[model samples]
Target: MDGTTLYAVDGGIARITLNRPGARNALNDQMIGELLDALDRAKHDDGVRVIVLTGAGDRAFCAGADLDGLGRDGMGVNDVRDSAPFRLFTAFPALGKPIIARLAGHAVAGGLGLAAACDLVIAADDVKLATPEVNVGLWPMMIMAIINRNVAPKHAFKLYYTGSRITAAEGREIGLVTEVVPRADLDARVDELAGVIASKSPLGLRRGRDAFFAIEGRPLEDQVAYLLSELVELAGTEDAKEGITAFLENRPPDFRGR
Candidate 1:
């Protein structure tokens, strides 16, 4: 919103870009606030069915927080719970719409958390992802929750302990990245994937996303019972009825987010 980030919606896709290319698109307080604002805007916009998040530069998708600005305002332990990064990461689960991270370059520290928070991550083959906070005498405390959910404990521990960078391919292998494409094909691939996701029923997508997050950490029996109720409710929606009818008629369904 303040030139620190860019927000644009076209053809049901909201593109939120980190604009501090000169600083490797690092997150400062202003950038983080602007990003949260963009996400909120997209979340409330009915026309936006999908979100694409990326940085403005080729050098790094995001190099993480701007360390120089961390304590500029005398931030302390008392402020950790209300920090912008904490709110941003927590916002993802409640956003309802799908988010696809476009990683054309490196994603490190909190940047990797940003990608992991998304529903999908499409990275360039040359991209590198890491949690190098240990190298700087700090830990990725805020992003640890997000990264852990996306990656297995063992692989995540190795990254945290060694402060090592992994290739995009390795990231996919370890479940942090969804797909890896060549740099030249990254934009096209991401766009294609985003388009496909955007064409789905908005109500279905929102309810399904909500259901998945709701079922996490629940007992197996409870999860199945909850999902069964959700499925029955979803099947009764207008979009679902239309989708079923259209299938029988060999035509595309017109979903109105119902």
Candidate 2:
């Protein structure tokens, strides 16, 4: 664990928390680096079947990037694309495991991007989300790619143009959030969802997730052909064979991630 982030694993779920509640869990360079490291650690850990990302307090999942920290080193506009936050944003799709964002509070700017990048977002009903970079004389540049993928173009444009905050229910309706529950029920809901994902075959989950990302933007025929090939390959894995056998025997499958 680093100062900016906390990492823990239990019951096949890796929990990575942004530990800067004092700063509303804003992303600084150090936090971004630590977050990427934690994600890498979880990705390589065979025992970790699912991941949950949240902040240290109920006030915010993350407020946004640390604006005060930006340009501290005379950073140029062109260099923004190569910054730590950019790398962290790109890292999510390559993890090959389900990531659930537990948004107990507001997720703004890059924070909203972080939640949108996750495979699923379980947000507290009281929470708000926004891409309010425009309010600060900037734009949600780095997060736009991820956000656009999750939210419809018109809705995304509205967010970028208005810099308005939307409720968790609105976020769900716009596809930014997977589910929303009362604040009291957030933890229980996240755990239940994570536990169910972790119980699946790890190998299957990994391959299936990889395919989910890979087939994006491909021609319809190409996507179908690629998925067919993937299915054939997956069917030959030991875990797949075991899964089929277990189904026939009316028992739970013991997947070894083979």
Candidate 3:
């Protein structure tokens, strides 16, 4: 759908690939616009139940924002807000659908933010994730916002401060990754999860997700009370009726994503 970002579908899964491998898939202006457009479309499209994001070629899922041509074409530090890497991850919570990151290689700087933005991430076992902006006399301060949400504050601080790279397993341990499989199994693992999501009820998934974040960090007593009330609303849905009936009948529920 976009030049720097590749889009494809298998069943209900929409796979969005970063295509600038030669540039280490660094996110540039073109890639950003395309990705935002694509994500917005996916959120509204009923045909797309799950979306998986990865980078083309194996060397890098994304190396972060492209720095090579900075100031070469009327771009400055301020102009960077329009860059794809910045826009993609920063506005992620607004994306109403589930995004699975299929990280095949290194995720650096802005790439790290993208990885952290996904609702879930299934990365290659050998994948390396880091935000090395400090090493270059810069800081991943912006990306750190997204990182702080998924990873422990201390862990996020340690990686950003040291500017050192960590393996996919370590990333998982620190909570940025949901699963890590061998390189050979990367696609298969992503596909498997995507299929699982595709089979479920989209409306229920979206509603639950929307409510999930709203409830985070709230007091346990308050959250529990809120959730209890929320269930009443869900029970009013047609999809919930099917789920309850299917459970009683001991059969899979046919969800229309209502």
* lDDT top scorer: 2
Model 2, range 1-258, lDDT digits (tens) per residue? 969999999999999999999999998878888999999999999999999999999999999888775444225546766767667888999998999999998999989999999999999999999998888798987789999999899999999999999999999999999999999999999999999999899999999999999999999999999999999999999999999999999999999999
Question: Compared to the true structure, candidate 3 yields what TM-score?
Answer: 0.91
What overall lDDT goes with each candidate model?
0.92, 0.92, 0.84
Candidate 2 lDDT (Cα, 0 to 1): 0.92
Candidate 1, which segments miss by more than 4 Å at Cα? 71-79
Give the range of the ten consecutive residues with the poorest summed lDDT in model 2. Answer: 69-78
**Reference-based lDDT, residue 171, model 3:** 94
How close to the true structure is residue 204 of candidate 2, measured as C-alpha lDDT? Answer: 98
lDDT of 3 at 149: 86
Q: Mind giving the per-residue lDDT tens digits that candidate 1 earns over 1-258?
A: 559999999999999999989999998988888999999999999999999999998899999889875444324647765767678889999999999999988999989998899999999999999999999798887789999998899999999998999999999999999999999999899999999989899999999999989999999999999999999999999999999999999998898999
* Candidate 2 segments whose C-alpha is farther than 4 A from its true place: 71-81
TM values, all candidates: 0.96, 0.96, 0.91
lDDT of 3: 0.84
Clashing residue pairs, candidate 3? 32-84
Model 2: clashing residue pairs? none
Ranking by TM-score: 1, 2, 3
Q: How many backbone clashes does candidate 2 have?
A: 0
lDDT of 3 by residue, 1-258 (tens): 758988887798888899888998987777777788878877777889888889999999989878763323333455876654555665677776788998988999989888888999999998899989889898887778888988888998899899999999999999999999998988888888899988888878887777787787899999889888877888888889998899999999998877
